[model samples]
Structure formats: structure tokens, C-alpha cells
Target: SAGSLQELLHVDIKVLMAGSTLRKVKSRSWKKQRHFRLLEDGLTIWYKSRWAGKGHSTFSVTELEMVREGHQSEVLLSIAEEFPAALCFTLVFHGRQGNLDLVAESPEEAQAWIQGVRKLIHRAQTMDEKERLDQWVWDWFQKADKNKDGKMNFKEVRKLLKMMNIEMNEEHAFHLFTMADKSGTGSLEIEQFVHFYKILTQRDEVWKVFQDYSGDGEKLMLEELDNFLRIEQQTGERSAQHAQELIERYEPSETGAMTLDGFQMYLCSQDGSIFKPEHQGLYQDMSQPLSHYFISSSHNTYLLEDQLRGHSSLEAYIKALKRGCRCVEVDSWDGNDGEPVVYHGHTLTSKILFRDIMSTLKEYAFKASDFPVILSLENHCGVEQQTVMAQHLRQILGDTLLTTLVDGQVPLQLPSPQVKIYAVGTDSFSLLLVYIPTFILYLCACRLNAHLLIASGHLIPTNSSKEKEKCGAENCPMASFALFSPLLQKSKSKLSRELSDLVVYCKSVHFHGFEHSRLHAKCYEMSSFSESKAKKLAKESGRDFVQYNTRQLSRIYPSGFRTDSSNYNPQDMWSVGCQIVALNFQTAGLEMDLNDGLFRQNNCCGYVLKPEFMTDGNAQFSPEKPDERQGYRPLRLSIQVISGQQLPKVNQKEGSIVDPLVRVEIYGVPQDQAKDETSHINNNGFNPVWNETLNFVITTPELALVRFVVEDYDKASRNDFIGQFTLPFKCIQAGYRHIHLLSRDGTAIPPSSLFVNISISELS
Candidate 1:
């Protein structure tokens, strides 16, 4: 809790020290002036009506995702004419929480609140293990100070312990409390309570590991630290240099030796974080064809709940895109006034205007990712409404809409989404739309190298060969490509030619057999399969599926049977090299967890390069038969579940403490798939110790995803989920690492983590 983090804590929210009144804009019609103030802890914002005597409502700092100034949000933009843009801002939260739109009386006031909240968010996000512990202890101390007198006595401390998921023996707890009461005062202040917290959370597991490595009990010598790094952590030739760096960074005092505190700090530091640091940046080759990467996509993106009755919203698209969903689906149906509405076409679902969806898409397309965002228009509209949709897309998306073919011609290889290409406006975009009844057509000025080849109906290599020759003809007057898919053709009578041309990279097609795809599929052609169908293909013809995806794209969507908006196991699709495994982003579960974890890398730009075996065109790889093929050696992974730190309590039942257990699950090839569980630590969600070692033999290490879940054990009914974290096997760092848990909605639950020792070695 020292240095820059400490400074950041104090500087954050300082601007909000003096309270101010701001207009809380709910919608255009509902606006109320409220007095908003930051709490003394600088981690919560308390707001209330100016005259009401009602208890104040508060928002936690950790819940905040970001603050946007100058009418960036839809809510802020809604009342843009009413309020000056400089005075308007939005507070965006993590997960599915609704955004808070506010307008200050003055521009200075708005800027102050915006910057202060941002700093506070940065402080929370940057806190390290030790800093987090300190902050957590302080927050608990405040919570347990029932009298609000800024101090706590033994009785209050006891209550705090219960709230923290500890059912310790009374005598022992009092003993530790007395030890921290150094001032001889009957009550302990915030600092004293923090000291007591340190005593309670002393890591014996860390100490024993340190004792095994350190020559002396007090400090680990340099050579001994190096040995631990090489042997336990499996570090390579840079172990000595890495050990020196650790000593310099974490050692309490530069005495040329690492103390136990330093050793623990090193283990919890970024250098020792469970996720490999290299993968945290733009490390992957983004230049590869988009099909070569597993793209994060959303299914039924506008629906916030059950597809049949859920509300449709632009907020849903905003949230998904901000969370790095690269591809978003909009089921377009004709609405009143020639507008196209997006929703479940045949259901009683609510609708959002297609133009509004496009507006939101344009605003947030590159917010989290610069890579191209594919608008999978499930067009169910007639020609009039479809043309309107086309106009809105061209007007709203304008320059972002990549309308021309690569090299002014159909390419032998699909263009990468990150490819640098230019096809400026020739003002013929609108002309491309009104020409045909069911076809979308657009051709850039034929000035580049190769001739463009396209077909009006479901175009593929073998089937659309005649259209290819016609499209290659000089001054080919008409421009149209594939709009026909099983899903769209079944419903829609007409779709705009311009809207279909807007669909780049993801040229949807009805998937035939693998043999058919191998013979007729082109790089740009993509197939959408329901989860059931994809799963069957993966099980029956896994190798052929993998091979077909190497040059082409495949999207696996949820089955229509999932009426409740549930998700299928995306791993089934991903195992067969299916790139866009779209899930119901609104639904939070293991499926979403895996999706988040898989794409939670490479700056989370919504693409993870598929494994070499899956992407290499000539390589022979089978998802079902991983053992028989490959140069990669099998891995023996050993994970020691050490202790949990401040786990969350589910069920919200008063006076109920959690009986938490840690479960390590592996998802990948069927042979490598397994789950290992530790016995539950009863009545303790705070700092529970298991020290149980779970081991697994992973045949396909490249494909395996490791998920660590902590659950509240219930003997009477099903166990409740507390928190989880998932990441690829290759991103894992060996030796002692902390798995910081995330809430069910994939938001960070700070200080809630499992301290574990991970060791990965090649299996004999």
C-alpha cells in the first residue's frame, strides 16, 4: 500500500471532497437534481434528494467501469439539446448494470467529477495484492464500526470476523485482537484493525514454501531464490536475472536478500500473475486471416433476457461491444414507417429500431477493439424497410463500412479484418441499394490489381463459378453477392442490396456436409450452425470440421431450443476450429465464463489466434483424436489449492457463513477434459485453507482452458456459485500464483482470490 498506489488513493476523489448538486438524467422526461458526494473512504458515492429525509443510496467505486464526458452515452445523448455537451457525462458500470447519466451546473464541475471518478477507478484497478488486502481490511473495519465512531471494540471486531467468513475460536480471536491493541485502548482504530487483519491472514503455506527455498528463516539468499524460480516456477535461462529483479522490486529493504514478505510479494506480483504477461498485450499476429482466430461474438445481442419476452435495447449492443464482442447479430424485421426493427422475429419480444442499432454500433464499434466488427444482419424485412436499413447503415456507419472487394477483385484468400485497405466514397452507395428487389449490390471503382468475382445468391467456389466469370467482365454493370442463407431465405421476401454488400468477411451460407464445404467453400464464405448440429459434427467428423475451418469461417449459435436464452458449451465448437462461437452475452454462466476467458487475451480485441494445428492448412489435426497427431508433448499439470482470500457469500441469507470449496476444471479435447475438487472448508469464506493438490494429464495442452471456481457448498441442495476465473493453459504461469476471482457476470471481485501453486511439466 505504498508509493504510487498510495498516492493514487489519496489523490482520487479529492476533487469531490466538497459535495455538489448534479442533475440525474434517467430519460428525456425524468430528470431530478440530486446532491452527490464522495464518501470519506473514497470508494463509494453517496447521493440523495436535496429535501428528502430518506436514507442515502450509495454506489461503490469498484462497480464503476469508466466515466464518459460530453454526451457520450445514449442517455446523455438523449437530452443533448437540453443540456450543454460539456456539462454532460455518463458513469458506465461493469456487468449488466445500467449507466448513470449526470449533468453538472457548470462545465468545471462536470470535468472535476469526471476526472476524480476516473482516478478513483484507476486506483481500484491498479491495486496490487498487498494494497488490495490493506484496502479490504480498511473497508471491513468501516463496515464493522457499527457506532460510526471511527473505532471498534472487541465485540465489534468479532462481528466483523463473522462478516468476513471466519468462524474462528473465540479465545484465539480475542488473543489476536489483544495483540493488535498496542495503544492499550479498549477500542481499535482503522490502523489497529488492519494490523489484526494481517495477523489473521498469515500465510503458513507461503512460509513453508519460503522455508524450503530460503537458506535462512528470515531471508531467501539470491542463489536460493534462483533455484526456486528455476525448479518450482520452471523459469528458463533468465532465472538468475529474474531473481535479482524480484529482490530489487519486492525486498522490504535492499539488503541483497528477499524476506518472506518479499517472496510472497513476488509470487503475487504481475511477474508472477497467473496470466502470462506477454499475452496481456497485442502479442498475436493480427495480420492472419480473420478465420484463423476465434472471434468473440454475441448471439441474439439485443435481447436482455428470455428471447420470447425479453426487452430489446441499444444498451445491450453497447455493453457487448464494450466488453469486446466483435460480431453482433441483429434480427431485422419490418417495423412501422418503413423502419426495420431488431428482435426475435416470430416471438412476442420487444423491438429496437434498426437505425438505432446502427447508431450504437457506429459509436462503439472500435471502443474496445480496432478490429472490424461484423454486423450479422438477420434480415427479415421487405424491400422498402430493407432499403431504409441500407440507408441508415450507409449514413451512420459511413467510412467504417468497408464496401469494396480486396484488390478490387475477389481474392483467393480472405482479407484479414486488420488489413489496411481503402475504397473511398464514389457517391454510388445509394445507387447500389435500389437496383434489385432481393439482392444487395456494390462494386468499388475497378482500379486495383485483380478483377472482382461475386454471385447474387449463396456464392461459393464450385457453385458460383459462372457468376465468377460474369463478375470478372470489364464494366460489369450490376454488383451483387450472397444474401441467401437458410435462416434469412426461409423468412424474408426481400433484402436491400446495399445492406447485403455491407456484410463483409462474414458471408453467411447454409452449411452442407464437410465434403461439400471442402469442395465448394471459399475463404470469405461463412456457415452458421445451431449448437446441436455443430456438436454432432464435432463429435462425428471432428477432423474434417477442423480442416474445413482453416480456410473458411464458421459461426456456432445457440440452439432455438434454448428458449430461456441459455448457452451451449462453446468448447464443442472451438475444439473443431469454429471461429465465431457466439453466445447469449446477457446470460452469465460457465459458457460465458469460458468465452470471456478464451478471449481475455491479446488485449481482448475479440480475437484469439487458433492453435497452429487448427490454422495450418496442410497440418493434420483431429479434435476427437488429439493423441494420435502432433509434435506437442503432453503436459502434467499440478495445482495446489492453498487458500482463499475474502470469497463472496451467495444466498444472502443472514447469519449464514459459506462452506466454500475450490474446483479446478479442464475443458479441451475429450481426453484432456477432467475436473478436480478440494474438500469444502466449512463456515469460512475468508482465508480458508485447503492445501490440497490437484493433478491432471493434458494431452492437448494448446487447446485446454483451465477454470478455477469457488462455490458455496450446500449439502441440502445444489452448491451455489461464488466466483470463477478461466484462462488458456499457455497463459498460465507456474509456481505460486493468485487466481483473482470474478463475479458471475465477469466483473472483478477485488481481493477475492485463491492463492495457489501451479506447476506444469511435460508428461513422460
Candidate 2:
């Protein structure tokens, strides 16, 4: 009886039959506020209750009916005359009768009350009534099946739940759909489908709903629909209000209303809640520039000590760091009593106390400006000492530090206004969500990419929330706060659909020089569920579908990109994940080596393509999309060339035009042409070395292996790299010979030697 009542109302309210006839009703109290939710043809109202702990109670109602002014008098007379046993009818006239809100004292009473309301609201005056309901149900199924692949997959379903910040796991996801698939066809069919939500989301499986209703037979029946819809609407309303308040509190606009984009900005702002930037030093300015490229040099005990010594004095440290390094990496372990002291590795020698290091920096009069440190703490200590390290770091650094740690185990890092701690090293990424309730891998990815932190995939937790939040409404209680992923999608309350509006809010924060890491590849991955639909539609439309995944990143990203994989063994898959964002790409103080061939040959050249819409640094992509497929626009590029030698352009006429499938050539010249040799081969293949051209032949995709030949010769070895470039077709082209002799260090390439860029567009 309790279960049935809970399903119809979608509330966590318990009806205790304390003494048979004396049933006691207790509702879950709101941890936050009250809101409204939608169910098909009905709605649910939710408010915090003193009796209920963390769940909501929902009740379904039918649409109101209208009667002429004179008819109301007749309707009341007819009801009293025809069925006197029925509860007294109340007229909430906005001209007619609203749906009945019947109160019942027993389970049987409530059941009778609902039946009465259903009869009163469901007007079967014509055949069109049934047809409309059928059409509505069918339309819903079509809409939910985003890929049009005939089945609603987990990824798709999870995206819907993500808007509400709910995270579901696979086993639970299966259970959710099984309950929703009313016909038991092992799949959802419109015929058996109803707008019943409580039937869909009553399970408590961790990831069941998060997978987007994957793998199962879960179709909601008509009877169970109202409760789910009502709960969702109520939760959504409450969440929207809470999110708006957060935006208003942290980043209020000149106007009272906060834009969605502005709210996103608030989360990713370094100077805001999660990351706070304090000004220091004599030249401190509110408008002081921050470093974009965060360079970290790793070494053993000697280098570690040297780095510490280099930054021992304020003047010296400022000079070394002002040259523009963003992170200072260190290794640490727990002492006998669980005290966190910094050391390179396990050692018997004197180790540096974290306080001592900070005191030394302080003694040097190093201002906060000189030490905008992202201390990467490598925890070699066991799990038992994990919290101890965290406690010590928080104690030593207070509010001025932002640190990231990665041990193999998931750490218990919670969210606080002052300290932003994340568990970096994990195998599934989802484990982070499991271990730490408020920590999300999705946000972590965004944080790392936007220069909020340097994240290793093992310890990094961004993409998991995107994949974890799609539990079907049937498998879990709508009001379970335990089901929500606070890090991925946040909400002031569990039932709110918009949750905290974290995604949109973070987007706004990113624009105001606050780096929200989730906006990049993580967005692409989260957006992929939708983007795939676009790709499918384009295929149907006969347009090329240039869809890019994590695998194809090499085609676009530069070849020399390196990430923090220190915690993992070199061979672990987590150690070699693709970089979603290159945080260091935009730092201004130092000349970056953009041409490291991590992607293609002649590693000395790199290109940065701006999407066509960016103008004056304002992003042009429409932030919102009707479907996931609608929003991504075309890409434009701005090329940056960094070479140990000069770069040569493709000479139109004189250069050999090798067939696309036959040959390839990359040109390199001396940094200073006057000091290098120039060459051109004669018809006899003899010594007319003034302008010699180099050609590389390729008969198959594997022939591109010639790109690796640079490793053979000492001088030319390691000169060319093929990191992320994809050799799509069997091809070859050896055109112009423009080689430049460059000194060991990459600096001062002669401008006249050759360096040029051209624009091209490709769809993804």
C-alpha cells in the first residue's frame, strides 16, 4: 500500500499504519525549497516536509474542465444527487472546475480518490481523446530516441538526466529501462508506453538511469506516469531558482537576471568560488596578466632540491618564475604520525616540511604574485594517510593554495569555497564519482584544460559525469539526493531538473578570463551524444559526416602535446589519453615550441585553427542547440609557426606535384640562411646543390612511416615528429627544398628563410 501510494504521488512520504485505522502520513522534508514538476496530463507539487528526510512527495492531477456559469450550479446539484458517497466537490473557478485534489484517510481512500480524478479529468467525449494520448506517447519515444537508431541507448538517456545532475550506473540503467518497457519486448514500444514516470524511475541502481536507458525493456504504463512528471517539474522549478541565486550571488550582472552563459563563467572563474586569485607584489594590478602556459619540469632529488633552492629568495624566485613557469611539481609522503611533509620520494634524509617551504618563500618576501603555484602533490603514501595529507595541505596553505593529487586510490576530496582538491589517478574515472561524492571528473577535465589545474587522466574526473547522469525515472526515487552527481551536474536539491545550471553557468565564466575546462573536448564528448545525431542527419542528407572522436584528435591537435601522466605506469591506457585542451597554448611570456611534430612530420611547425565564428575573441558558436547536432559551427584557423629552422612554402610551379597517393615531402631550412647551404639538383642528378629538393614516396598509408626517418640521423634525428597527424590516403609529394641550419636551442629563425600559412576548412 505504501509503495503504491509512493508511486502515484512520487513522494518519499511514508504512510505508517501505526494502528490499523490510525494511519500516520509523514512527508520528506525539503533540504532546499519547493517546486512544480510535469507529468503527462497532470502535474506534481513538491515542498520540503518536516517528516521526510531527503525525498519529495508528488501527486498527479488531470487538466481542469470548463463549464458555463449556469452549468456550475447544475453540475454541483448533479454530483450530490447522483453520487452522495463521493467526497464534496469544491469549485476553483477561473470560470470552471480545476482537477480534483482529493484527500483520503486510507490507502483505499486514496485509490478511490485518484480514480475519481482520472474520470473527471479524462474526457472521452470523442475518439480524438485516445488518439491524442497515443500520438503524444509516440512523439515522446521518437524524441527520446535521439540517434534514430531505433533504440534509446544509455549515452542518450544519461544526457537527459545530466540536466538534472543525476548519475546512474549500468546495472541500474538496465533495471530502469526494464521497468519502463512495460510490454517486456526487451525494448520500448510506443503502444505500451504511457506518460508514467514513477513506473520508469523507481530503482536505486547507481548508474542505471545514467546510461540513457540502455539495454532493456522499460516502458512506463499509463497509471504510473503522473507521479514521475509531477516530481520532475517540481524539482526542476526548485533547481532553476537555486541556480539563478548562485549566479546572482557569485556573478550578478548589471541587470538582475543572470544569463546562462554568465552562470557557467562563475564556476570556472579563477578569481571566484573554486579558484581565488589574490594580488601580491609591488606591481600588483587588478588587471595583472596571468600565465597561460604552465610549464612543469620534473626531476629526481637533485632537481627537486635545486628548484626549491632556485626559488629560495624572492628576487631570484621572481626572476626564475617570471620567465613564466606555471606549476611547481613535488612529491610527498606521510611521516610516522601521518604528517604530510614534502619529499621527492621515500627517504631517510631530512625532508622539507610544507610549512618550512612556505616560510622560506615568505622570508624571501615572495608575494602571492610570484607564487601562483599549482602544487602537484604525488602521494606515494598509502590510503590510510590520504586524508592526513589533505588535512596538512589545507592547514599549511590555508585559502591561498590550489592543489591536485593523484594516488591510485580515490581520495575523499570535498568541495569548499577556499580549497579546490581533486583525485587525479583513477582507472575508470567513474571511480572518482564513487569515492568522492562532490568530485566530478567532467569538471576536473574542464579545470585542467582551462589552466585551472594540471590534471592527469588517472586522477582527473571530467568525462565520467557526462556519461553517468542518465538514470531512467523508473529505477530510482526522484528525490534521492544520493543519486545526484554534485561534481558533474549540481543542484540545490535532488529533484530539480535544471539542477544548478552548472554547464551553462560555467560557459559564461569562461568568457571573462575564467577558464572553465569543460567547455572544450569534454563538452565535445558530452555534446557528442547530440553531435552524433547531427552526423547521422547529415549522412541522410547526403552531406559528408566529418565526425571527430577522441581517436581522431591527432588529426587536429598539435603533435608535441604532453600531459601529466606521472602517477600511471608508462604503458597504462590512462597514461596516454588524448589531451582535450592545451592549457599552455595561449601563455604570452615565453616563445612556445608549437612545431613539435607530435601530430605530423617536420615537428617544427604547428597550427592553431580558430573556429570561423570567433571575432575579436568572442566565441561565435551559438551556445545553445535545439538538438546536439545544431550548434557546432565551422572552424577557422590561425597558424603559429615555431621552428629550429626556417619553414618553406609549397612552390606552385617548380615543385614536383606528386600524386596524392604516391609521395610526400616536408621542407625545413636553416634558422639563418646566410650561414647554411642551399641546393637545387640538376637533370643529371649531379652537383647543382644550390636548390635541392627532397622527395618522399609513399604507396600506402603505412608508407607515411617515412616520417619517422628523422630519428635515424643525429642532426636530423628527433627533428621531425608525427604525433597527432593522420595520413588519410596513400600519398606522396616532394616539392620544395628549403632547409635551414638551426642552433640546438630553438631561437632566431631567419624571417627570410621561409614560413607561411594558408587557411582550410574541414567539418567535424
Compare the candidates by lDDT and give the number of the best one: 1
Candidate 1: worst-modelled 10 consecutive residues by lDDT: 435-444
TM-score of 2: 0.24
lDDT scores for all predictions?
0.80, 0.26
Candidate 2 structure quality by residue, lDDT tens digits, 170-206: 5775677677766666655443334233344222221
TM-score of each: 0.89, 0.24
Worst 10-residue lDDT window, candidate 2: 505-514
For model 2, the local distance difference test gives 0.26
Pairs that collide in candidate 1 are 409-452, 439-497, 440-497
Off by over 4 Å in 1: 1-15, 28-33, 49-54, 81-87, 105-108, 422-492, 503-505, 651-654
For model 1, how does the per-residue alpha-carbon lDDT over 635-731 read when each residue is reduced to its tens digit? 9999999999888878565477899999999999988889989999999998899999999999898889999999999999999999999999989
Give the clash count for each candidate.
Answer: 3, 116
